[model samples]
Target: MKDLGLIPEGYKILVTATVQEEDCDGLCWQYIHNEDKIKPEFVVSTEPTDGGIYRGHRGRMEIRVDVKGISCHGSAPERGDNAIYKMADILKDVEALNANGCEDKDAIKGLVKMLDPKFNPNHYEDARFLGRGTCTVSQIFFTSPSRCAVADSCSISIDRRMTAGETWESCLKEIEDLPACKKHGAKVSMYLYDRPAWTGLVYETECYFPTWINRETAGHVQAVADAHKALYGDKRIGSETAMNLRNRPLIDKWTFSTNGVAIQGRYGIPCVGFGPGAESQAHAPNEIIWKQDLVTCAAVYALVPSMYKGKGDEDVCQFRAGGTDTTSDKSAC
Candidate 1:
């Protein structure tokens, strides 16, 4: 467009290619926003949206639970406190927390409680739209003096997906309040990321990614939807091989996370998603994207900036999860 003189004179387009997103989602953007001091009026995420205008997605976090015990000879296991046994109790409760219903009669109120107006008063509807939150024990580890002795410690890593009305503090508190966790005095905490980017820059932060949702009628969101309508008609456009999976609503939300976690979820900057490829193809063995999707997305993206009538004050954000109390002040290279 620059060479063809197609860009409007008053409009400026900045393309940022970030790094280390796979290691720690949105950490690069946090650096760009805080260290580089570059904040765009709005951001358009190019994550695979399966040919739809995407406004939001559930965020995620990493949680760790640790339990301590005493080790003794395997022959006399009864003499020692078994960490794995204690962890078994907590693990059962964790499974029930994920599998139980939100009804008052249920022994454990699952994360589905976020979808109930009685529990999530402020954002239950949005929670329903984004779907319920979930928690699963993704990894487990244990340690002992030797294989012949009782385990002295056990730990688990929880993969937590957050819907609207869920926050880092609240999620941690939920685990702390669990009957087994309280009984065994389990230590629950959020994981931290301090890995180096390809550029050798380390931006440390908590693993909490905030959930964000934008109003479907928000200016930035509408701009992409309108642009698609004008360029590709009222439905998703894709190659013959891809059309079968693209038959959903023209406007939707991503089932996966994206850089929008920080752009919109953390800083309140307006963000929307429209990109090539299908969500199912992500990380698949024979991942593929159609050539036709590339052209369609490019044409729509070019027209969106002009169609956007600028931001509005109609509460563009439906819900943005709150941040943690501690802030990382580490300097990046």
Candidate 2:
């Protein structure tokens, strides 16, 4: 495309590979850049998913709830307060929060307004597109004097999946304000991820990854859709028969998080996903990628940068005017 004068002159593409990505806990981008200083204007993650255009995915974070109490011998349980019982109360509220049954659900907290096809109490348009925020108890532990003693301290780890219009701070504050949490004096906080990379460099980062979605009418998505149509010519792949039948646009979102958590979720860089293999194949037995998926993906990736006429940089867009393409001719973008 560049040799054929399709690529603009000032643009350049830099691809990268990383080590310990699987164990980095989403620090692959941070490790590579901190080690080598690789910056970018935007990111396109070709993370494994059955070949399709993914505009965004739900964000996620790690939450820790610490409950404190007094310990006692198992024979004399009445002598001390049980932290595990307090944790059980907090857990009930957490479950009710996920189910949207809390009394203060009318508050501006983002979760209650969730709008899934199966459950939409408020009819929020954004939730209709991105689904709802979610939370669940992922891990639990208690500090006990002995195996037969009452627990003095207990902590539960919560995995929170954030939807649009939600933030890490808000989620934490919401949990802190829960009736059971306040009653139990539970300390709600976001976890910090500080693990050493294979390179032995330890970088500490918060666990909050924000949510993102590219509007279907946005220029970047339009460019990608144009490239897909140009290369694939309206041919459907995989299990897209329903989309084909309904005549809906082929854009999608990942069910699982990707490096897009850092690229777009944290940095606010424009991003979209297209890749080979199914998400089900990710981290599963007998993972595989088809040869044609790679070829098709490469063609689409190469075509997007040229098709993308970004904002505030129109001087480099040298297109053949009055021939076929006629999207824009405005100056001073």
TM-scores, one per candidate: 0.94, 0.79
Q: Report how far off residue 209 is in candidate 2 (Å).
A: 0.4
Return the TM-score for candidate 2, rounded to 2 decimals.
0.79
| Residue range 165-253, candidate 2, lDDT tens digits | 55566678879998889898999998887777667767887776656666565666667777888888654354442233323346777
Clashing pairs in 1: none
Q: Which pairs of residues clash in candidate 2, taking residues 3 or more apart in a chain or in different chains?
A: 50-277
lDDT of 1 by residue, 41-60 (tens): 88999999989999999999
Alpha carbon RMSD to native, model 2? 8.6
Question: In candidate 2, what residue range of length 10 has the lowest lDDT sum?
Answer: 316-325
Q: How does residue 117 of candidate 2 score in lDDT?
A: 31
RMSD of each: 3.8, 8.6
| Each model's lDDT | 0.87, 0.68
Count clashing residue pairs per candidate.
0, 1
Number of the top candidate by lDDT?
1
